[model samples]
Target: MTTALGLVAGVLTTASWLPQLRRSWRTRSTDDLAWSYLVMLSAGVGLWLTYGVAVADVAVVAANAVTLAALGALIALKGVGRGREEAAR
Candidate 1:
């Protein structure tokens, strides 16, 4: 049951980001994404990771680990890309 739930959660969260990620990649524009939100979200994910570790929950740890990395990548790339855009202008 726990494994099932983990599977569901993993699929749901990963799939939820698919559309936005795809669009951002294709358009090469994450300007619509809010930096503040991502910043806060990354912090929250960090907390989630810590909590998962404290509780010794593998699913929580694994999911948050992968998600945190992905989200962090997006945030970094978006900031860098935006900066480049500003400099180019």
Candidate 2:
């Protein structure tokens, strides 16, 4: 039951990033997303993943892994968008 709860929590929290990712992907712009925000989120999520691994929490590990991937993609998109903007200038 606790594991179930954890999974539910994980899913909810992780899903929060999907909308932003989808929007960013569709628009190919993440100018609204601050670099500091992305860096902090990635760092915090990485730590959660590490903790999950250390504690052998499958739900946490799974959720954080997915989140990290999303964050990585977001960061990449942000960089690409920045480059595009710079090239335009």
Best by lDDT: 2
TM-score of 2: 0.91
What CA root-mean-square deviation does each model show from the true structure?
Answer: 1.9, 1.3
C-alpha lDDT score of every prediction, in listed order: 0.83, 0.93
lDDT of each residue in 1-89, candidate 2, tens digit only: 98778778888989998998999999997988999999998999999999999999888899999999999999999999999989999
Error of 1 at 23 (Å): 2.4
Model 2 ranges with Cα > 4 A deviation: none
> Which candidate comes out best when scored by TM-score?
2
- Candidate 2 global lDDT: 0.93
